[model samples]
Target: MSGHAAFAVTVDLAVFTIRDGIFSVLLVERGTEPFAGSWALPGGFVEADEDAETAAWRELREETGVERFEGHLEQLRTYSAPDRDPRMRVVSVAHVAFAPDLPAPAPGSDAANARWWAVEDLLDGGPDAPPLAFDHATILADARERIRAKLEYTTLAREFVAEPFTLPELRRVYAAVWGSPPDLGNFRRKVLGTDGFVVPTDTHGVSASGGRPALLYRRGEATDIQPPMLRTAGEDD
Candidate 1:
């Protein structure tokens, strides 16, 4: 085992949510060295006795203080570039998590601050975009694409809304992720036609603008869309 290199393992999370129709991700300002003061995905080194997923959840709770989450959480991929971490050889197991509009986060001891940033603003290469620490920008971009693709053929969209939600609420989740809204009529038909995608309830949701109340629904038993709700160009207009 002579001359064998030792590496550290970490877990990075791309925790996403839709707030006021804008898709956002949780980021923290690193308080320590290597990227001090830079914003990065909320994560940290994996513990010696825990798995990657457990570390991901732990980091999420510690960095963001999100204890009650009822949404999707899954492993995205791994990053093991030799130069990824300037300090030493490090490999990261990335995870993608989705939740409904989450509350403001309290930064943990390792972070200077924590807040939600619009995913578009971070990836748009604008002057206002804060530079991400390490390789988080790449991990976030990949996670965004994964959510967008999954929304096309899965009930993953439901993870963005609370139960007993209206169709409009669900539609907005798609709009937030896809960067545009789907056609109202087409979206309704597709969702209703796709059995088990949603279960209608007798109650209706009150419109804030005094419009007619909309029917309420909850996520159903199905996980896959039958024909798949494919996004099309100019469908929003």
Candidate 2:
């Protein structure tokens, strides 16, 4: 078996979901050697001839058994730390995806037990996550940075909101992620000015419902957020 060293690429995904207005992620505990018994992002070595993104999507399906998920996906970067893998030198292209709604995750394939852990609770390792196996801590930190960037200059926040939402409702999404709320008047005007950011409705909640009726709005087709919703960085919070 001389010169039989295996050559491979690995793909790890940070699949995020928001439900009940809190952020969460999907993770699995490895059941095999080479980091077995330790938690890691849902992932595996890319099969031969598989493209990076394709391998990532396939890994998501195999490990999580999820048929459909709609939201943005992006390449978060790669982990090539020389000492990243103990058995062999390996490189992993990482990814981060957002899910509009929460779905229960179950163990599959090489995972010992699959689960969805809340964002705040997940990192703390209390009833959700434990320090992940491999260099997953670096992977997770990378994913979080990308999502933070996605929050600005894009409509990514709406994915967490229901079909219909008011400015105040949407504002909370920003506040939740930014740790501090943005200026309401500035935020409202910023969104309204951006084409395809939100669409108007002829039939409002009809402001005279014997209460202060809220205005109606839905997701805009435009992906670009004009004036890019500014925010303080996560660490600044």
Candidate 3:
């Protein structure tokens, strides 16, 4: 390992949250050179005293005004392509997180502005869409695919909702994330038939519009989803 050049480490966050029934991700406008005036994910250099996860959370809080985030924050992957960044040799540890709702964000640290953009719009990728700086576009795409894949084999979808949720409400989470609606009857059957998928809360939720009360449920102890919900043709059923 002798004679090798030193490199710097940083963290980039793709924070996705469901707000007003829309799936969105947090973004910050770049305020520094090497792509100034461009939209990008919230992130920064990792301090010498901080670990990768800690640095990610710190940057998330600092840039997006999230003092305390309640959701899953997992390391998506590391990006080390030689020319991915300019100015120096830097490696980024990308992270992805999910939450029910997040407070409005303000510009902080080196970010010129912080805002939430609809995941659909971000994925559209056209001349009219907001462009991402650096390799952030790739990072965001990877993070999104990771969450969609997780939904097939894990209870991670429950993270997008609060407790005492109804079947219809839970189904919407899948639709929003997958960008397509799942058949209600088939979805209900699959969820209920799967052992330890969800447990009834012995309570009902009243609709604000004065309709029939819907049964409520809470997450079960199961982590893996038996008979996974695949996106392939003839697999959803």
TM-score against native, each model: 0.88, 0.85, 0.89
lDDT of 2: 0.77
lDDT per residue as tens, model 2, 56-135: 88887777776556678888888888778887878899989886765787677888888776655655456745777888
Model 3 misplaced stretches (Cα beyond 4 Å) = 126-128, 201-214
* Candidate 3 lDDT for residue 129: 57
Q: Compare candidates 1 and 3 on TM-score and give the better one.
A: 3
List, residue by residue over 1-237, the lDDT tens digit for candidate 1.
779899999999998988878899999999999999999998889999999988888888887787747788889999999999999999999999888768899998688899999999999776678999999999999999988878888888887788889999999899989888877777887799888999999999988999899999999999987566778833423
Which regions of candidate 1 fall more than 4 Å away from where they truly are?
202-214, 233-237
Highest lDDT model number: 1
Worst lDDT 10-window in candidate 3: 228-237
Per-residue CA lDDT of model 3 for 43-162, tens digit only, reads 989999999999998997887777767777899999998888887888999999887767889888888899888888888764555879989989999999988888877888887678
Q: Candidate 1 clashing pairs?
A: none
Assess candidate 3 and give its lDDT.
Answer: 0.85
Alpha-carbon lDDT, every model: 0.88, 0.77, 0.85
